[model samples]
Target: MCSHYEPVITKKQLATHFKVADLEDGLKPELWPGYIGPFIRKHEYADVGDDAVPFRELMVGSFGMIPHWSKDTKIARMTYNARSETVAEKPSFRDAWRLNRHCIIPAQAIFEPDWSTGKAVPTRIVRTDGKPMGIAGIWTGWKNPANGEILRSFSMLTVNADDHEFMRNFHKPQDEKRMVVILQEEDYDGWLSATWQDSRQYLKQFPAELMQTQTEAWTTDLP
Candidate 1:
C-alpha cells in the first residue's frame, strides 16, 4: 500500500469518473500523511445539500483515518492505510469498518517503492486506461473535543499481494507484498453502500493487465 499518492485533483473524479457534484474544501495535488484530499461516500438523506445529487457525494478529508478517541490529528500519520485482514479488529479502524463507512479514494496514481535495484526507487502505478482509480476505503469524522470542530478522514484498504504479479514486483524483496484494493468503475455504487459482509468481496487486487508504471521518481517540492 502507498503512503504517498496523487489524488484526483481535476473535475473528472466527480464530473465523469465518480459522477458527483461538489468537491468541498477542494483537494491536494498529492496526499501524504495528513494532507487533505477528496473521498466519495454514499449520499445519505440526512446530508445537507440539494436533493438532486446522484448516489455518491464527494467530500474533503484528511488522508489518514482519524479515530474519535484521538486527542489530536497526529494519529493520521500511522493510519493512512488499513490492512483488510485485520481492519475489523484494529482499534482505530475497527469502528469504521464494522459500520461499513465505506468510501472511494479517487487517485490519479499511487507511488510504490521498487526495491529490485537493492534500494528503494519511487515508482508511480496507474491504470492503463488512464482513468482515475476508485480505491476502496473506510472513512470517519473526528470531532475536536476542544472546539467541536469535526474533520473527516479516511484510510485506504489493502490486501496481501504475495500472489499478485504486478504488485508483487514493488516493495522490498524480503518484505511482505501488498497492494490497495481498486474497485471496478461499475462497482462504485455497490462498494459505497456495501454492508460489512458484502464489503469483503471488493477487497481484492486489481488485475495487473490494466495497469502501467512510471519508474522515474518525483518530488513534492516541484509537483
Candidate 2:
C-alpha cells in the first residue's frame, strides 16, 4: 500500500513549472517532507462538466479518500490508494472511477516501499529527465453535516508494476501491485480529455526508462 509518500515542491515552484497563473491562497511553497503539508500537483485540472478547469480554486487535498457514501470521515484512512485493476468494479471506487475520474496529482518526487530484504525501505523516485511527474487521480467533495463545511479530497490510482524497475521492488513479490500512476506529457491531453475512452487509453504504464530511483532519508513530518 502507498500509505506514505511525498510532494515536496512548493506552490510557487509548481505554478512556474506547470505554467499556471495562480496558486490557491492558503497553499504554502515550502517542500513537504511528510504528512504535515498539502500535496502539490501540476499539469492537471479539476473535472468540471465537459472541460478541464484550472487549479486556481482547488485546494491541495489530503491523499486519502473520503467517499460520499460513508457515515464518518474515518474511512478515508484506508482509502488512500485505490487499485486501478479493480477501480471499475470496486464498490468504493467504481462510481467515481466512471463519472468522477478527474484531476492529476503533481509531484517533484514520490517514495515507494522496497521490502526485498524482509523490512520495508523507502526509495525516492523521480522523472529521469528531472521534470515533475503527474499521477492519475480522482477527487470528491464531502459536506460536513453540522457545520456545513465542505472538504475536497482525492486518491491516486495504482496498477500492476510490470515495467517499472523501481516500482517492482515496492509491491509484494507475489502481488506485484504498486501505487502512483505517472503520466506522460505527450498523453496529458488525452488522459484529461473529456471523453473517458480517450483518457483510459492513456492510462498505460509510463516509459520505464523515464524513471529513476534512489534510497532517500525518511521522515514522518512534512516540511
Candidate 3:
C-alpha cells in the first residue's frame, strides 16, 4: 500500500495538469494519511449539458477515508488504503464504490521500502520519463455532527503486486506484495466515469519499464 508520496508541483501546475481552474492552496511537498492534498473530480455546473465539456474541479481532500457512519476520525488511519480485489465488498469502501464516487490522487512520486539492502531503506519511485501519476481512488464526505461541516476524504486502491518485477521488491519478505493502481493518461476519464462493474478493469498494475527508483542515503538515517 502507498503510505508516503510527494507532490512536487505548484497549485497552478496541478490545476493546469488536470485542466481545471486555478487552486488557491497547495499541498506540502510530502504527505501522510491525515494530511490534506489535491484531488481532481468532476463537478456539476449549472447550464452545462452532459455533452458539453465536463466541469473538472481540483480540490484539497484529506488523504484518509472517514466513513460516514464512523463516530470519530480514528478509523481514518486504517482506511487509507482499500484493496481493489474486495473494495466493493469491504464495509469501509463498499458504499463509495457502489455510488461510484471516484477521484484521482496525483503525485510526482511515491516512497516505498527497499529491502534488498540488509536493512529496510526508504526509496523514492517515479516514472522514468518524469511524468506525474494519477492514482485511482474513491472518495466520500462525512459531516462533523458538532458543526455540521463536511469533511471529504479519499483512499487509494491497491492490487496484488507479487508478480510485478518492480513492485514485488517493496515491503517485508513475509508480507504480501501490493501496489497502488496508477491509471494511464488515456484511461483517466474512463476510470472516473466507470460504473461499479467496470471499475475492476482499471485495477491492473502499471508498466514496470516506465518506472524508476532512487534511494536517498540521508532518508534512511536514524533520527
Q: Report the lDDT tens digits of candidate 3 across residue range 1-223.
A: 9888875357565765666655555557777787777777766461277656656667677788888998877777788899998998888899999998888888889988878776777789998887888899999988888898988889999999999999999999988999999999888888877888888899999998978896554332221
Judged by TM-score, which candidate is best?
Answer: 1
Model 2, residue 15: C-alpha shift (Å): 1.9
Global lDDT of model 1: 0.89
**Best-to-worst lDDT order:** 1, 3, 2
Q: Candidate 2: deviation at residue 202, Å? A: 1.9
What stretches of model 2 exceed 4 Å from their correct place? 24-58, 221-223
Q: Could you give candidate 1's per-residue lDDT for residues 19-105 as a string of tens digits? A: 876666556788898989999899875246766756787888899999999999999999999999999999999999988899999
Q: Candidate 1, 19: how far from true, in Å?
A: 0.2
TM-score of model 2 relative to the true fold?
A: 0.78
lDDT of every model, 2 decimals: 0.89, 0.61, 0.82
Q: How far is 182's C-alpha from truth in model 3 (Å)?
A: 0.5
TM-scores of the candidates are 0.93, 0.78, 0.91
Better of 2 and 3 by TM-score: 3
| Residue 42 alpha-carbon offset, candidate 1, angstroms | 0.4
Model 2 lDDT tens row, 15-115: 66544444446443323211223433323444444356663333466556666776666766777777777777876676666774566666777766667
On a 0 to 100 scale, what is the lDDT of residue 87 in model 3? Answer: 92
Which residue pairs clash within candidate 3?
none
